[model samples]
Target chain A: MTEPGRQGTPLIQLRGVERVYGQGDARVVALGGIDLDVWPGEFVALMGPSGSGKSTTMNILGCLDTPTRGSYRLGDLEVTELDGDGRALLRRYTLGFVFQGFHLLPRVTAQENVELPLVYQGVPTHERRLRARESLAQVGLSGREHHVPSELSGGQQQRVAIARAIVSQPKVLLADEPTGNLDSARSHEIMALLTRFNRERHLTIVMVTHEPDIAAYARRVVHFRDGHIERIEESS
Target chain B: MLGNALREAIRSLGRNALRSFLTVLGIVIGVGAVIAMVTLGRGATQAVSDQISSLGSNIVFLRPARGFGPGQSIIPFKVEDAQALAREVPGVVWSTPVSLRTLTVVAGNQSWSTTVVGAGEGYLEARRWEIVRGRGFLPSELRAGVAVCIIGQTVARELFGADDPIGQRMRVDKFSCEIIGLLDAKGQSAMGNDQDDIALIPLRTFQRRISGSTDVDSIQLSLADGVDNERVLQDIRLVLRERRHLSANMEDNFRLVDSKEIERTLTSTTRMLTTLLGAVAGISLLVGGIGIMNIMLVSVTERTREIGIRLAIGARAADVMLQFLVEAVVLSFLGGTIGIILALTFSFVAAQKLAFPFSPDYGIVVIAALFSGAIGIVFGFFPARRAARLDPIEALRHE
Candidate 1:
């Protein structure tokens, strides 16, 4: 894997980003002014208790939500300046996400679930099928391609979701508490798979979790509290 | 992308097959009722025109008009009035004074209740009726009021059965008459009355032997081909008014019934009824559209998380909207197809039962199909907009 310090330019940069909700009396601050940078090929973890703005930060990074104030840049594009559709296009071409709930469409088979992102990209059918199968195999789900979400175990379903996120070869994978519902053994297996992708493909990763044991799998860990980044530490 | 959206729509609808069917049931019933009503209404209108045209297009009936009130009296016409109209009116090709009475006629122990008509010479020609057997009345027989009669097909069947009615004797109220001719069958009139259940005798004979009065009920006239009907009618009115001695300011004690006028009135009335039925059925179609809207709203709400998933995975809002819209369209289109089939079957059977023509209006069928699809687009829009506008962050958080 490439060393984070060896990279001259960060792949992702956030400068004084702030997110606010509602207005007037109903106003709430979900994220205070914060600054951060992530180089290419880095596995980063965000850790905080509930309401610490970690989830909010992950949402903003995934382009699912926009910063209310300040600049966010993914590569050369200014994300905070983009419109809803523009941000959606950015997500479609550059970002992937694995959620805590493993949000696979309930009745769709694993192969179809993995093919969704490619479908959104207007990929042709035969090639889409081939890529989806390859992604599923990469996640160690070769024979479970036709099984629906309800028929699969939680770990297998999350793997399918991971396969879906990475199927289009996105530049960055944003995983929010991906193993939150899995057992300790399944969580380790999932963490190892994420780590292998990060090293083997040099894919940038940004993950959020509350557990230190899970945070330990990343090369760097950032702690958050009360809508602000408290500190960040690196590990060899 | 369109193909994918369509596949997605079909798959989602299949997930709730029972709900989808129930949702489209309203549309099915609405379209079916509209098509059946229009188809059957057209058939009834066609039947009316056909029946009226069968009565001969150039015929007109002149009858004494009763005054407005309930107990008002009517002045009967004389046979001389028919003769005067026939001579003085330019377009009057044939005219006959007709008097009618319902009587029970007995022949060889077989008796039947039927109408007995008293008419002057050339009555059959005025009515465009043919003598299917035997002969018409002789001039001497008609002028001398002889006891000879002609029987219609229905009268022949009821009084004589398979035997020849010509040369047979049937008893009128106070006299016996020999059958000299047989009239062809005319089937039923527009009013559903049996037209062929009648016996015809000379007017003088009827006046002398049956009623002992010289009163005529009505005058039947046939206009010559290509004549101006209104001019001829005005001429007849003038002649009748002078003969009956009506002053210039007095209303003539007569009324004219033209075949064309009757046909127009009847057709317009049936068309109005058809429009009324179509409007009522259109209201039901609107209700069906509302049902679709209601179900689509529910479906969007139920699939909030799915929308979120799609959006989070980088699907455009338009994509999500298209999927739901296509689902609604497919649903209503399916209902339209089934409704058309049901309507065709129902109208076919009903036409057979009602004894009218079975003519399906293909234009209306095509219109109903397209209209049902339009309903989907119109009603499905609001819910689709709601789905497309959802915030992915909140939607993903929804359980």
Candidate 2:
């Protein structure tokens, strides 16, 4: 167990983690035994083919799924064996998710989408609005708070997703294929914004992508194939 | 949480305005049917009592057990029985022995068929009948069996027309009778019969002249003031039993009908019919509740990603359940409120057309609204649970 308010410790740790779906003869392994540690203020990239188990690892790290076997610790909390509500609380206070589709509620304004986390935390309405506005401004969306997902371009919508991810100031941000749906120009723009946040705000960002240019923006890359990590590379 | 839920519900409803309206229509119709059936039932009951009271409180009807059935002799009731009851009952204010027969009445060149009733002098007091002109038949004329008659408004209009009907002669089949008196007009009965469309004559004279029998069809009885009806009825029943030589175990051969008993029967029948109508209308509410369940399930499905998003943020499963539950309840409550308003408006217009007083019980309206809300809770549970149990990843992945 890690003590609370500790500094200079890893933000996330995984030891011999394994995830299996189904049973008996029909069983499929999504993740083989693996060990990894992610320190604070680091940006890592996970690259793999389809069914290479990278997405499964991301899902587990995001608190959306539990590993069948292994010890997984998120900051000071042991999350591998957390109950439904415990996992929910871990997701609330520790993790934020960015999906490939920029899953912003279509009917709500960008500001309202960012305020959703505060709403579940029972924050006051006025304070929630202020914090959401601040997050949007921080993401370079100062004048776009009222625009819904449909009204915004692909890059703008992805920025809103990033704003939503960091609005609560979580310990880690897990983005699955963040730039997968954008054109090259929009993709580069999104990556630049992510790079700036990592350097300026010192946020720990773990992004999954197969594009070499997208991976080049990350400080470290972990390559996966056939349900196992193949190599680790330090990008220059 | 409440604000977000309310905003989301409003937005979702706004998104599919037609679907929302269609979903609520069943609830509206159900509630409207309940209000309409109950209101009209109460109004009909009130109208009946009003009409019955207008017939006066002193009148009582007596008929034989067979009740003037077809193919039965009209001489079942005896004039002697009426005389015996008049002499024996303690609260007998007055008794009118009456006999009726259908006869063709002829005057001058015109003739029409009408009912002729043979009644004693006390019949005027029993029926509250007033003489509009001329004078009543004398007691001596009744003893002498002189042929005299009192004509009603309709009979006078047919026979005398713009002229004085008193002192005129009219033919009853083969006999000539002088119209000694004219009766005031009485309004139509609730059953649409004209109360003043007949003629009255001396009981003895008619028994000898037209019926050629000494029997009376029935007798009218008027009771004294402040009389205990149950006691009087028991006393009358006892006397009639003795007069008819009825055994202790035998049922009375005559039916002594009272105004109160008739009122009770009519009110109960109206109550039963009202309940039946209300039950039929209540089925619509059940269907409406099912409609709410169906819509709520659809809503939960439509908002799957929203539920996942809220859950992913920190919302407990119970919180998600409560939001959807509240939304369903709010939808049903809105439907109930609108339905009540519409039903009241319909009842107002209907009351005017029916010529009856309009009044709705707010207690019933509130109860109905609460009942609809409960329906929402019961029906909304499954969908709310389904929403709460959604996998955040799969839900976020949903289109």
Candidate 3:
């Protein structure tokens, strides 16, 4: 494992990224002229009102969508205009995601959910299980190995989703409203767990949320409005 | 990735157990219907072929051609024509002239109107008639025009009961004929004729005593091995026309009919029925395939959020498509296996009760299964594409 603070290279670079939807008279801009850089071992938060393009930025950052115009680099690969399959390949190898609802597959056990990313990576079964178990243990879910999402509480389910996101040891971890569905205490617990994973494992974390308290947990906060970035704040 | 997709599909099916079972039910009934129809058709074809084969192989029948209808003119078959058939045709094994008429026979007190056919020695072999008791007409008995006849089991039962029928005398019209042989039971024909309720006698005796004429109604011909019926029929016709002194342009006063022609017609009819049944079954299989597609599409819709999550976590579009396609295939294949089992059960019961040869061809089963899988792929594609092409944010937003 690499050291947490030594994020030696520029892991992601974006310049003038724009995403437009529809066509002709119906054309609307979802993301416009955004420039940003995200490095490894960094916890960043993107905050905005609904329809302010925070989700669009998160999507572009996650490689789930491409910008209509711009140059974007994920690690060493230029990925802004990658085809569907190439983008999928990038997601498989270099990214892991946690969604707002915990997004834990309801029927699978907690351990199986943790093992999902490694499945896409084509890791052998025994190795995947071992890594998934270690991730679950790291997230304080060792005894809940066989528990399904429905069997666990909101916090435990979010921890399982976090475990899934980190299991592949992906280059970047993107969390979209990871604690949006949890209570305040559970939200804090999820944030603490995510921060620990970022600090201890040196995982790059990009979280999207509307809560200022959630954004405060990150080292940097980026605010967006009306499809454009408004301001960026750095805190010790 | 493939494993995850499979595990997810299985889990989804388990979660919605009732819907899944109902979807599978459609496939089950469709496949079952196809197999049942096909099996019945196959059995019918086999039964018909067996019935035809039960009749004598390489046997031909010739009927006298009257002026316009039966009993109009007495231009019936003659012994001369029968002799000419035996001597002239290259592959002719034997020929026998026969005359048949219905008459009431009285033995002790029992009386029954049974078919009494007059034939020579060759008729027994030519018609596949078996002797269960006594002996067939001997050459001396035939030449002497002795009033000896063979009785079928049905006739014997109606007249003799448990008593020995051989050497018993029965009154036919006014003359008495001694029973010389009893033919084995032959059951019923497709035309519903009672084949076993008949009596056989020497043609000479019938011509001289019973019918009061030397004219035969029909001539039965048996050919040697490897003789083609078409060529031999042509030879028989040509020889008979020349012997009868009929002009080439004139219509023949005799009809030479090959039993093989009847065999061909029956076989073609059976084939037609088989085709019709198979086509109907094929429609069911197609319906089963469409059911699979419909279910798969619903599955795609229900799993959109899951698909979006997978996409976010690094699944390729092709992966999404393959997952759903495999699910559809699994459902169809399972249905096919169950259908084959059901078909076998139906066939076994039908064979046991109806005595038809019920056999299911594994080749057809395999073809049906393959067809089902192909349908799954074609139909599962659209929904799978929808899942793959989903906007992750929009999908996550879906309620």
Give me the candidate number with maximum TM-score. 1
lDDT of 2 by residue, B40-81 (tens): 777777776766655556456777674233553323567777
On DockQ, the stronger of 2 and 3 is: 3
DockQ winner between 1 and 3, please give it.
Answer: 1
- Could you tell me the lDDT of residue B73 within candidate 2? 35
Model 3, A1-236: lDDT tens digits are 45445347678788899999999999999988898888878888999999999998888888877899998998888996688889888888888888888887777799888887788788998999999999999989999999988999999998998888888888889999998999999999999998888888778999999999999999889999998999999877
Clashing residue pairs for model 2: none
Q: TM-score of chain B only, all predictions?
A: 0.93, 0.80, 0.89
Worst 10 residues of 3 chain B by lDDT: B66-75
Tell me how large the interface RMSD of candidate 2 is: 1.7
Tens digits of per-residue lDDT for model 3, B1-399:
666667666766777777766776656666676777777767766766666555677778888775443555546767888998899898888898889999999998999999989887688888777898999899998888898989999999999899999999998877899998999887765445778999888888888878998888888888886877678889998988888777766677777777667767876787787777767767776777677778877877787887887877877877777778777766667677777778779877987787778778777778767765666677667767777778766776666
Q: Pick the candidate with the highest DockQ.
A: 1
What's the CA error at residue A193 for candidate 3, in Å?
0.7
Per-prediction DockQ? 0.77, 0.50, 0.72
Off by over 4 Å in 1: A1-8, B66-73, B138-140, B162-164
